[model samples]
Target: AVLKATGAKGVAEPAAVLAAGGGRLLVKKMKWKNVTVAIAEISNPLSVSPNEPAL
Candidate 1:
């Protein structure tokens, strides 16, 4: 299980989690838009070119 490291509201938020190595994840304790969010991992943002297929 994961959790917040602290409870004190700094009246400001921390740095972006994704930039901080959150691995592209997001959780909504309360629904702001009442919508679900899905996350997927990218093994490689760059794909092999059709002309240069991998062996």
Candidate 2:
């Protein structure tokens, strides 16, 4: 259910997961979309940080 919501196939390999270091979740796209979505849960609940800063 969670995977479907996020559109991820499955958890990344052990090494890849370690490399991420809890920084972000990598999502693999199925279609030809030229975009990637990384998901992660933040620890600081009160902090409101934008996913991407203005360019």
Candidate 3:
């Protein structure tokens, strides 16, 4: 798998969400050329948004 070959975890579509801390999928997998992408909304975001400013 990708993680095994690249030593990078969660580079694949199926594992993307889980890698992002098990959130809902905002965007499904899309493929183009030699790339695959997915977007996930983390259940617990670790950082405050830039617009919100840190407290």
Candidate 4:
């Protein structure tokens, strides 16, 4: 199966690998003040990466 991850730490490697396999990588920032919650409005942003596959 394909792999997935989120946030800054997950922006590389896995994202590239998944994209290379024809997958979109969804990324969002986690809110750390109160709890671990997503508070961003982003979508399949891996298209900019050199190794990511085209949409």
Q: What do the candidate models score in CA lDDT, each in turn?
A: 0.35, 0.42, 0.71, 0.42
Candidate 2, superposed: residue stretches over 4 Å from native? 1-32, 47-55
Model 1 has an lDDT value of: 0.35
Looking at model 3, the pairs that clash are none
Off by over 4 Å in 3: 1-11, 46-55
In model 2, the clashing pairs are: none
Error of 2 at 50 (Å): 13
* Candidate 4 residue lDDT tens string, 7-31: 3443344544444453443444354
Worst lDDT 10-window in candidate 2: 36-45
Error of 4 at 41 (Å): 28
Task: Look at candidate 4 and tell me the lDDT of residue 31.
Answer: 48
Task: Judging by TM-score, tell me the better candidate of 1 and 4.
Answer: 4
**Residue 46 error for model 1, in Å?**
1.8
| TM-score of every model versus the real structure | 0.22, 0.26, 0.55, 0.24
lDDT of 3: 0.71
Q: Model 3 over residues 14-48: C-alpha lDDT tens digits?
A: 56678667778888877788788898877677654
lDDT for position 23 in model 3: 72
User: Whose TM-score is greatest here?
Assistant: 3
**Every model: Cα RMSD to truth:** 10.1, 10.4, 5.2, 11.2
lDDT value, candidate 4, whole model: 0.42
